[model samples]
Target: MDVLVVGDANPDLVLRGDVRPRFGQAEQLLTGADLVLGGSAAITAAGCARLGLDTLLLTALGDDVFGVITRQRLEERGVTLLLQPSGDVPTGLSVILTPPGDDRAILTLPGTIPALRPEDVTDAHLSAARHVHVASLYLQPRLAAGLAGVFARARALGVGTSLDTNWDPTEKWESITDILAYTDVFLPNANELRAVTGSTDVDRAAASLVATGTTVVMKNGAAGARAWWPGGECSAPGRPVDVVDTTGAGDSFNAGFLAGRLAGLPIPEAIGWAATAGSLSTRASGGTAAQATRAELA
Candidate 1:
């Protein structure tokens, strides 16, 4: 595999329209509701596979209907699955309430997402990939604990690693700071970057992370994405497309950038590819639905 994506494997129960739930025995209606393959790592893995990378996804799911659907979706996108299917628990699930634009509210049930341990990244997992990516850190307790060893082992084998710290439900962003030392590429959207750093200035927040010797891919919705490293910075304007849902835009960007890097594209050019991939992802109701392939990019 060209890259291995480690983290949650789940399905999204997405509803489109004004999805705010009211209290006092009120009922709401939505124009559309669909169950689709989801989870940050799964989406990115699928995106990479669709873009022609030999991608492997290491995640945990339950031996249930959702898990079956998840496996089918991943395979349909040509991703190699190394999933841990648990008979003891159910698959993770996220409810996405999209309000006619990019803005969305998500409710997640952790389930088996927190069951992946560090031991999951063995010699077989690390040796088969040139790059390894992990997402949804704050939600995966077991995976989070073993993350350091995973990165270190992958590094010792000359493999690069990236991390996408999706929203922290607890609002405490301290757990991820220590792991940046092992991360080669850190992909975080502008809001997450700001909140993680507790900085009002996004650029300053990015600088603080870059100071740790990690390349930061700062994703700014519509404005595009910027890559900052030691003494160098590159930015690209996001491609404009018909808006649908923005669920996996950031994960798609991560896949695009990593695919570019693995294919030896220059960093600036890769950021442009990432921006384009991210923009294209919003054209569908689900996160991976409109993911672009390498041909679409041209």
Candidate 2:
């Protein structure tokens, strides 16, 4: 496997078109809705597989209808699954409401997500893949608890590592400070960078993270992304595309950038690829459907 992705696995129940809630006894209609395979890690693995990498997805699922759908989609995308079904807990789920301007409000149910253990993420898995990507750090409590040890083990095995510590539900934004030092590729949105570093300024926040020897890629959606190293930084302008849905676009961007780096592309070219990959993914409602392959990227 070229990349090993570790995180939650779930199906996204997406509701599009001005969605709103009604009172206790009332119900509203939605213009569109679909059940699709989604999760930051799953999307990244699908993106990498589509871009021609041998991708391995390490996560847990449940023996349910949603899990079946998730597994099918991942397999169709050529991702080798190292997933197990838990009899006790149901699979995770996300209910997304996408309104105008590609904005989304998400309600996530963490079922089997918190059950993922660092022990399952074996050192052999780390040795096989050239790179390992961990997503949605804050969602999985068990995984996040041992992330530093897992990441440290990956590094000790000479495997490259990346982390997309998605929104912290608890709002505490803890544990990332130590793990950042073990991360080779750290992807965070502008807001996350600020929240994690407790800085009102982007430059200062990025610097705080960069000083840990991790290359920080700050995602700014419409403004594209910026990458900062020890003493240098570069920005990639956003790709102009008709936005359909922004869900998982950042995960797709991480996939593109990591793919570029693994392929030995220059930083500028890699960020360009990431911007394009992310923008193009918005052409469809879900994350994986519109992802471009390596041939398409060319």
Candidate 3:
């Protein structure tokens, strides 16, 4: 199936330090540092392409150095690009500091990523894909608000929809209803589910999100993922692999799960593919590192 990934594309600068520093203090540095193409959609699209899918990235990139590097990285991975070029501002960039086994803090500049609009995605592009996955909704207000119309148009053309929401407690979730109503699949991590639904229990959170008019898949990190609908619940365990970095695991999981589902696999099997892909992604540095191929996933 052809997959169209619509969302953020940012260059990720990773710094490994021994201990996370306090607000005013400096940190002890560790060795392994590298740059990679990140942002939820970019990573997921690259993962999908690596897993042998026909993938296209519908995103905005600045006419700058970071954008050049980001585009080069995506092209190197064989993911097709549908770029909307921006000349006024630089491309989005994220500074990620991974201090051993924990969640990393991200400092990002929206740059060109938040500038994507419905008009930016042409009908020819939208109609060409079987599935359109748009991610990081909270990070881009205009695109997030405009997604309902895009989904409506895609639905008219018989294309399925998926959303990988990033956490933004600031936006009113009420505004997301229309877009969610048209979504075929909703993919969010456990924390994101809570942020979107204001619930703590995994089942309750998933239920609340699914009630918003789409099937829910809650990515529960090390515990695996929970896929649910009105009357059914399916869980997949995380694969045990030696860890290096947890940067792009969730995005890779989204890629694997969607790839499996598009191939007509059962929900349980899809989650298994997702979990393994997510786990294997951490074996190397950076978000796109160590992403598995279709053969490896099989």
Candidate 4:
């Protein structure tokens, strides 16, 4: 495998147009509703595969309809799976309420999202891959607790490691510093960077993380992306696109950036690839619906 992605795997129920709910036994009509593959790890893996990387995803999934759908979608996107069955719990699910704007709301039922543990990532898994990427850290408390050790092991095995924490539902961003010490790349959006570093300024937040020797790559929505390392920093402007949905765009960006790095591209060029991949993914509703292929990115 060229890349190994470890984290949550589930389906997303996306609803658009007039998605806000009203009380008092009232019902409203929606413009569209679609069930699609979700989870940050899954999306990132799918994106990497689409970008021509041999990708493997290690995640937990229940033997439920959602799990089956997730599996099928990932396979269709060319991502190999290393699934851990979620015992009696149903597969996780997220209901994304996308209004007629960029901002949206997500209500998640974390049935099996927290099932992955550190022990699940064995030595063989790290040795088989050139790079390892972890996602949705807050969703898996057990895995998060041991991620530092996992990354350390990957590093020891001569594998590069990256992390995308997604969002912290509890709003308490904890246990990140230890992991950064072992992480090669730290991927986070602007808001998440601020929340994690407790800094209102993006430069300060990125600097704080980069000080730990991990390269900090930040996603800034329409503003594109920026990267900061020990001795240098660079940025890429956002590509202009008619965005239909912003779901999973950042994950695609992560894939593009990693793909460029694995292919020996410089930071500035990798950031350009990241921005292009993220912009192209918004051409459709779900995260994987309009993900760019390697040729498209080229």
Candidate 5:
């Protein structure tokens, strides 16, 4: 395997246009609604597979309709699934409300999202892959608690590890330093970088993290992405595109960067690939709907 992705895998029910909720039994009309594959890990895996990487997604899912849909969508994208059964609990689900020209609000039921444990990622799994990427760290508490050890083990086997901790609802950015000690790459958005490092200045936050020997990749939305390492840094401007939905653009960017690194591209060129992939993903409604292929990224 070229990459092993560990994290959440579920279906996202996306509703667009005038999505703000009203109280007192008020009913609102929506412009569109569609159920599609989501979860940071799943989207990143799909993006890697679309980029021609041999990707394997290790996640927990229930035997439910949503689980079935998630499986089908991932398989269609050529991602190999390593299923972890979530006994009794239904699969996790997220309802994304995308208001016109505004940021989206997500309501999530973390049914199986937090089910994955450190033991689930066996030594065999780590040794088989050239790289391992973990996503949605806040959503998977059990795995997050022990991810440092997992990454350390991967590093011992000469495998690279990266992490993208999606938003933390608790607002407590804990245990990140330990994880970063073993992480080769750390991906985060501007807001998350500040939150994790407790520094409002992006440069300071990224530099602090880079001091620990891990590459810090900050996603700057329209401004594009920037990366900082011990002795160097690079950046790429975002590609211009008509964005339909910004659901999984960041995750796609993570995939592109990792894919480029695995393929021996330099940090600056990889940032270009990351920006292009992220911009192209927003061309459709869902996260994976308009994800770029290898040719498209080229």
Candidate 6:
């Protein structure tokens, strides 16, 4: 399958601690840090590669050390890198603080990631893909602003479109309504959906999101996920995986779900596979640490 993943690219520096420090209070660090390729698109693309897909990643990275590492990692994963030249800015970096529990916080810098534009993605890139996944729409303005047009073009080229609605504090969620008109499948976690739609009712929110002409997969972490189409809905219960860090779980879920779809599995089965991938992702230090392969999912 030809899968295109576009959006943010960053290096994640994860520091594992047993307890979160109080304001100025120092805590003992249990595990040493590990640097890994992160960001929604990057993790998703890596997971896709692990699933044995022909994946292409379109993104922007700065000319710094972090950028170099990001590119090298992508190449090592066998993902085609369609990188745009970043002017003077540094590559994006996320300082991931993962406490002993499953929760974590990210201190991130967009750096050159916000510069990915429509011109960065060529007609060839769109036409060559059977499926295109647009990620972090709210975090990358240039790409995010032009997403609807991009999806429309991809559709004309007979490509299916999926969107991973990563969070943006300043996102105009209502504006995203228009983009869904061209999106075939919409993937969002529970919190992201709540923030975007300003509602807590999953059914109501899923219905509202699907009303905009997109199939909705409302991801409720740890509790499993829900998939809503026009005529029907399906849900898969979350598996009990030993939780470590909850960083890249959602992105991996997207990869597993897409992999299932490409393999011609039913939606319910796809969601089950997706949840398994997500749950397995939490067994290590960082987001991609415990990434599961297709064989593992099966």
Taken over the whole model, the C-alpha lDDT of each candidate is 0.88, 0.87, 0.86, 0.93, 0.93, 0.85
Model 5 per-residue lDDT tens digits across residues 201-255: 9999999989889899889998899999989998899989998999999999999
User: Which of 1 and 3 is ahead in lDDT?
Assistant: 1
lDDT of 1: 0.88
Q: What are the runs in model 5 whose C-alpha is more than 4 Å off?
A: none
Full candidate order by lDDT, most accurate first = 5, 4, 1, 2, 3, 6
Compute each candidate's TM-score over C-alphas.
Answer: 0.95, 0.96, 0.94, 0.98, 0.98, 0.94
In candidate 6, residue 29 scores what lDDT? 54
In candidate 3, which residue pairs get closer than 3 Å at backbone N, Cα or C atoms, i.e. clash? none
Clashes of each: 0, 0, 0, 0, 0, 0
RMSD of 2: 1.3
Extract clashing residue pairs from model 6: none
lDDT of 1 by residue, 183-264 (tens): 9999998888888889989789889988888899988889889989898998999997988888889999998898889889
- Candidate 6's TM-score reads 0.94
Please report the TM-score between candidate 5 and the true structure. Answer: 0.98
Q: After superposition, which runs of candidate 6 have C-alpha atoms over 4 Å from their true positions?
A: 18-30
Off by over 4 Å in 1: 23-27
RMSD (CA, Å), each prediction: 1.5, 1.3, 2.0, 1.0, 0.9, 2.0
Worst 10 residues of 3 by lDDT: 18-27
lDDT of 6 by residue, 105-162 (tens): 8888989878888667777989888899988887787787778888888888899999
Residue runs of model 4 more than 4 Å from their true location after superposition: none
Quote the RMSD, in angstroms, for model 6: 2.0
Candidate 3 positional error at 293, Å: 1.3
Q: Model 1 residue 265 lDDT? A: 94
**lDDT, candidate 3, 168-199, per-residue tens:** 74756645768888888888887767767777
**Which lDDT tens digits does candidate 2 get at residues 41-92?**
9999999998988999999998888888889999999999998557778889
